[model samples]
Target: MWTIYLGLTGLAAANPQVVGLGNYTGALEDPRFLTSLWLTVLYVGGSAIIGQAGLGFTLAGILRTRTGPVRRLVEGVVLLSWIPPSTVVGFLWFALLDRDEGTLNALLHTPGFAWLLDHPLLSIIIFDVWRGTAFSMMLYAAALENVPPAHLETARLADAGVLQQPRDVVFPASAATS
Candidate 1:
């Protein structure tokens, strides 16, 4: 992959003397590198899996039933977040959390939390959730649309509400389709 090539190129450029297992051992011992790995795992699990999965499914279910101006507006907002460049998201978050006079601190009327210095991991995790939830919403919207209306109606006739209907009918329908 181009990714491997790029990584190797950067490695070779950064440390010409670094070779083979030595580089690997050095990297493994690097605290910053290790912390980066942990942060990545946390972000993937917390934001991508948990935040995205739950919110996406919930929004998709709503979009499936609700149609009109409200749905259109919400979809537009989600799509806007989904399409922005990563750098823009990072910049926007930086502004929002900029300790000294960040709007969040002002609005919350609390002392600034030293996020960038002390809790960069949590800061990035929050950023990831905010930026990535829309993607999950979009994916789930498609998934929800594919569920059969007849099945939903049948589940309703069986005296099932939202939770029961989705659990008994929608999830099984999705599983079979997948």
Candidate 2:
């Protein structure tokens, strides 16, 4: 672990010289680095914090009450997102977002609009939301499963609405998993 951590601080594989912290200082001074860092924060906040977590919790709540084909179909779609290899997922996104022959352009009838180049940050954030939603969904589902029946009963006795019960009981209990 120590070796791996130390290795990341040194030179690139192409460069023979080991410049400890030199690359870090250079990156800190670069304007492009600052832009990239801001974009990274946006990507994480938009995709993971808001998009995935919110969608996952909503799916868990909806699917838990559902039965038969509806539940199966929803689960299958969520599972499918996680089943593909990361490389394959990346290629699929690239193909879908391609400017000339991309699916989006074809559907919209607006070809020659380079989405990847024109909106790289947004593209990556959206891609990440799509890719990561399954994990959060599964996590929330498992957490919801472990919620005690007493919580629901108490909420019911109090005449709490459906949404309020989850906020007061289910969500508080499942907060750790999320």
Candidate 3:
């Protein structure tokens, strides 16, 4: 083990020196890099903050008490978003958002509108939200479902509705990190 570790260390030492910070500085000096950074921030804010955490929480809360075949159907559809590959999600979004022959543009009959070129950041954000929000919703569903019965009963005794109980008890409990 010592010999192997020494060999690995020697191999690493033999590699050419790489100035990681210099590369970062060079990239940061480029206008394209700044634009990319802005786009990345926009994507994260729009999809993760606004779409996933916001809308996903609402969907989970609304579906929490839903039962029967309709609930199952909804679950199935939502699970599809969670189960597919990210690349597949991107491709599907591209198909829908394509300029000339895209499904959305065709359905809306909005000719000459290039979704990809005109709204690259927004397009990616929408695709990411569509693909990733299901996981957040499912997580919220599980968290809400696993609330302690005693707390729920206490909330019930206090005349809290299902919605109120989750807000007052379950959400805080599940959101807390050790």
* TM-score for each of the candidates: 0.71, 0.75, 0.69
Pairs of residues at least 3 apart in sequence or in different chains that clash in candidate 3: none
Please list the residue runs of candidate 3 whose C-alpha ends up more than 4 Å from where it truly belongs after superposition: 1-35, 149-167, 175-178
CA error at residue 163 for candidate 3, angstroms: 8.9
Supply the global lDDT for candidate 2.
0.85
Clashes of each: 0, 0, 0
**lDDT per model vs. reference:** 0.77, 0.85, 0.79
Local accuracy of candidate 3 as per-residue lDDT tens digits, 1-178 = 7644543342356673444355557768999999999878887899999988877887887787688898888878877988978788778888888888799998999976899999877877877787778888888888877767687789899999867986898777777731
lDDT of 1 by residue, 12-119 (tens): 666554244655567789999999998788878887787778777887788877889999998888778768788887787777787887767778885576557677
Pick by TM-score: which candidate is best? 2
Q: Pick by lDDT: which candidate is best? A: 2
